[model samples]
Target: MTQVHLLDSIFTRLVAWSIAVCTAVVLILGTLVGAKFEQLSVDMQEAAVNADMATLLDAYRDGGQASLASRIDERLNFRTPSGNAPHYLLVAADGRRVAGDLTDWPGIDTGEMTAIPLPDGSYVHARAVDLPAGQRLLVARESAMDEMVLNEIGIAFVIGGLFVVLAVGVAGRITAGRLSKRVGRINAAFKNPDERRLERLDRDRNAQDEIGELTRHSSEALQRLNRLVDAHRDTLDQIAHEMRTPLMHLDARLLRAIRTAPDDAAAQGLVDARGDIRTVIATLESLLDISHSEANRGDPRGLEPVDLSAMIENIADLYAGSAEETGHRFEVDIAPGVTVRGEEMQLTRLVTNLLDNAFKYTQSGGTVCVELVAEGPVLTVADTGPGVPVEDRDRIFERFIRAKGNHGASGGSGLGLALARAIARRHGLVLRLKPTLRGACFEVRPESTVDAG
Candidate 1:
């Protein structure tokens, strides 16, 4: 009684079909039963008429009116086809009631030599008679007292149809519910690979149904899709990382050559061309690395123990001369002996990118602090200059991401942080921003690490 509609679901379709079946059954059965009932009534009426004719002929032969009438009444049995006995009556051509059963008349027509209603509200038709007497005999049967056969048959048919429909509906609902549960489980597994509770719904395709086959195919499809995405990501990261180092070396050599060249105009022009070529190569490599890191689907790098504290200090020392010449305070506080497991070159690049970004954003006289600390296995870099805005902090770490007015002011490919993060992940480290009111803090965690000594 939930009022399921025909179009709602597959279960509804089944229910609708069952209803249609029942309706058809009822119509067919009703027609057959009705026809049988009519046929039986005609047969009974014909039998009664024949019996009346025989009785009338016998009366003439016996030559006894009273006894003949009595015989006719007894032979008719005064009972209708429905089995409810009622009195039998006869009306002669003289319009006089002869010796018979009923006295009251219920207005019946006896004509056409076919079954007809008599005056006693019973049905009768013609019977053979002696023409000289101008008398006709007829047999009458009561409609209500006739057989009640079709009533029970109709009831049985209706009950049976109802039971069949109910059984079908229940079966359909159970099947649909099971299908829904299976689909839900498969979807959950696809969304979260870490959860392995879903059954191998996709493993088997032997079922002769469409849904079963889909389940089997979908499992393979999802796995293949995941693999492809991962491969693409790894390719992008590899292109970016491999290209950056060589580009740096090329740029450094170009600038060195330009500085050492003579003051001739032709020599200067060659130096400028080399610089331009180096810039072009660096740009192309940076763009690719940015694209790859943003995908976050690549294979991570190999990990090795790195002296992160010393790494930070060394970078600071390398940049200290410029900081002093520019009248900027370059602070360095790297706790000694802090070690992390990561790709050393990649981790160095990560720190270097952050330092370069800080130097670019801070004014010449503004202070830049580089502090490296190891907490357990976590390495944190906190800088102080004009810290990135809350809105721009996360975006700045992205490749080709530059702050307003900082574009073309520096010679970076804008993929340093992106590549750094990629390398960190490859080494199985989590690199993220630590909340700070100062410049920026990028923290990297090694899988197995210890505090700085």
Candidate 2:
């Protein structure tokens, strides 16, 4: 897994997009409402001013124009009977100034209430009406207070919108983080594709959400797949057990026929047939060994701390006669007390498989070296032969797979290294091909690659 940058994270992107949507919505709605605030404020102010205008018009109708003049003068002086203070304008049809505080008609749109600016750099909301005899009556209120309150409300909306966006971002972060963690657990479960090693994904199994359902399905699928794999392994084991008897009987019959052959040539043919049967038996046994190791990989039940140094020395001694027979120089570099917890027989087979490959692949007079070190308790077996191609390094560890460009020897059944790797993994270690300037090198190290079964 690699570190994801903040901007690259889907959670961060969602948060940013959410904040953007919130801001856009707020600004759009606020603009729509804000554009109407001045007019809306004017309409509210019109209610009070219109009532005052009605009273003055009633005065003019009941007690003549003189009574209206007197009322306007009293209203300007704050002495009017009206509860609200309002400014006024009255004009004749000739544009003659009627009784009012204003020097002239402040010409503006009429009928509906609208905002108007006065010379003092202040706003007023006013409405004009046609009176009798072509007279025009205008009513207005100074709107500084209304504008102040509206400005404050706009500021509040902006602050509130920012807070809402922040809250949304926090929520998005938490939700995204939780989802990422759940998905990460699923990834960890399938990280190892090996069916035997892959863990079951079983988080939130009872949950009704998508991830929970996915986990449930994944676990079920894994169980079915593992069952099928176990069945297949059982069938192979049964077949190997069934075949071993016939191969042993055939080998015995060939041995008996070879002793009673009519001549040396007839005996030689029997010997070759026996050798072919023996090869088949060895391949079948190797397959069974690999299967057993893989099935119990990481099981610590029967493991013992075996001294790797002594084990390598013993195997080397066993191969000493073969080394002498082939005129190959056998080199040993064993670090004493290099011990590891493992099945002794499986561990011994692991050593033998690597050494066998070395001896089988190397030419006469070539060098085969075995090394064990305490640092990793690492074991290394190097041979002087045509080295494995870089591309085939990993493939050669697979059962029945051999390097395409080898030293002209079809390494027997090609399961030696595969079985070796299986045994190493069973003991919670890693067996790998080491890149060497000389012939092939195989290494088994205390590289923990498994957990307890």
Candidate 3:
């Protein structure tokens, strides 16, 4: 059960107010009651001092308890005292007691009129009188002490408690609402890469507050990331451009050796050299693509619906025969009209990489399959091969990482999966390997990151 803590910061303030209000009400009521009780007691004492004892005795004997009770009632009513009740008693000489309904004196005597104790532990007025018959008379009034004061105090406490609870609840709700709104704004701004104001705000948090410090640190980290990305892009471009010169020269030398080879072995060596050069060129081109994708990540190009199933089928068909020649069967299971939001060229590259991986890893006579399943706006690509090991599954998507003991010597630069992930991210899509048995399943999550629905 959830408990309300009245001593906490905001609740404490409300509780204090409630206590003050209740105490003030109780104190005021107690003062008025005590003062009135004092005045009534003094009047009763004076009446006892000036009583005609013989007359009181005669009235008590003739009129009985009712007459005595009536006389005290009259005295109190005429006095209009605040603390005295309408019922009282009068004791006569010879130990005879006369009261409205009281059978005995209700309190201890202090030799003077103090408070008349009632059976219920409250007090009123009690006074002793000396009669002319040498008998004594005690006049006492019945009244309730704390019950009336407590009744008033209880009402005040209830009202104060309600106000306190309401105030605390409203304060907490307002606080939570403000915090949620701030969090929502931050999320919306971060999602919009085009919003410079959000970027600036992220850079400006330098105060002592935790959120401010965190924002400042994040801004600094983002700046460093951008710098690293720029440097990486420049390096890739430079390396690719520089390697082209040496690759072209190597191609020229191989061509001359092919044209004037002294023997069949020499000509074959040159052909082998040419193949190696082609592989290097392909690797460099892949690196350049990775760099370009990273550099252009922030570009907000409009998205269009493209048939992903058709693209998957095209790539699978292109490599179907090649896989067959390697003693592996290649097939495609693509649903028709499964449209997605992205560039056609990037999606093609993504599909091709997956198929290539499937063909490269599976043993001879093993089956390689490419599939596209669309559910609503999501696109999935599944392949059956020697699936990636659990520990290296996520690592394979990083740049230049290849799973150990799997497809390491399979003539790839290990950038295929990385490039695919990059392209998917640029289009605001999440690409992750879905868990599966006997195969690798990669999911292209719902394209909700774009401006479109």
Winning candidate number (TM-score): 3
Error of 3 at 378 (Å): 6.8
Task: List, residue by residue over 69-174, the lDDT tens digit for candidate 3.
Answer: 5665565456534543444445555556644446675545534756655666765556655544544456555443334554565566566656665675566556
Higher-lDDT candidate among 1 and 3? 3
lDDT of each: 0.62, 0.80, 0.65
Q: By lDDT, who's the top model here?
A: 2
Across 39-132, the per-residue lDDT of candidate 2 in tens digits comes to 7876778787788778887988988767888888888887533322467888888999887766667777567777666666666777888888
Per-residue accuracy of model 1 over 225-306 as CA lDDT, tens digit each = 6577678877876876687667777777767777777777856886777777777776776566445444432232334677
List all candidate RMSDs to the true structure. Answer: 13.0, 7.6, 8.9
Candidates by TM-score, descending order: 3, 2, 1
Query: Which portions of model 1 miss their true places by more than 4 Å?
Result: 1-11, 48-64, 72-83, 101-132, 143-147, 180-199, 203-209, 252-453
TM-score on alpha carbons, each prediction: 0.51, 0.58, 0.59
TM-score winner, 2 or 3: 3
Model 2, which residues run further than 4 Å from truth? Answer: 1-39, 45-69, 77-85, 88-121, 126-139, 148-216, 245-274, 289-359, 364-384, 388-406, 409-411, 417-453
- Greater-TM-score candidate between 1 and 2: 2
Report backbone clashes per prediction.
14, 0, 1
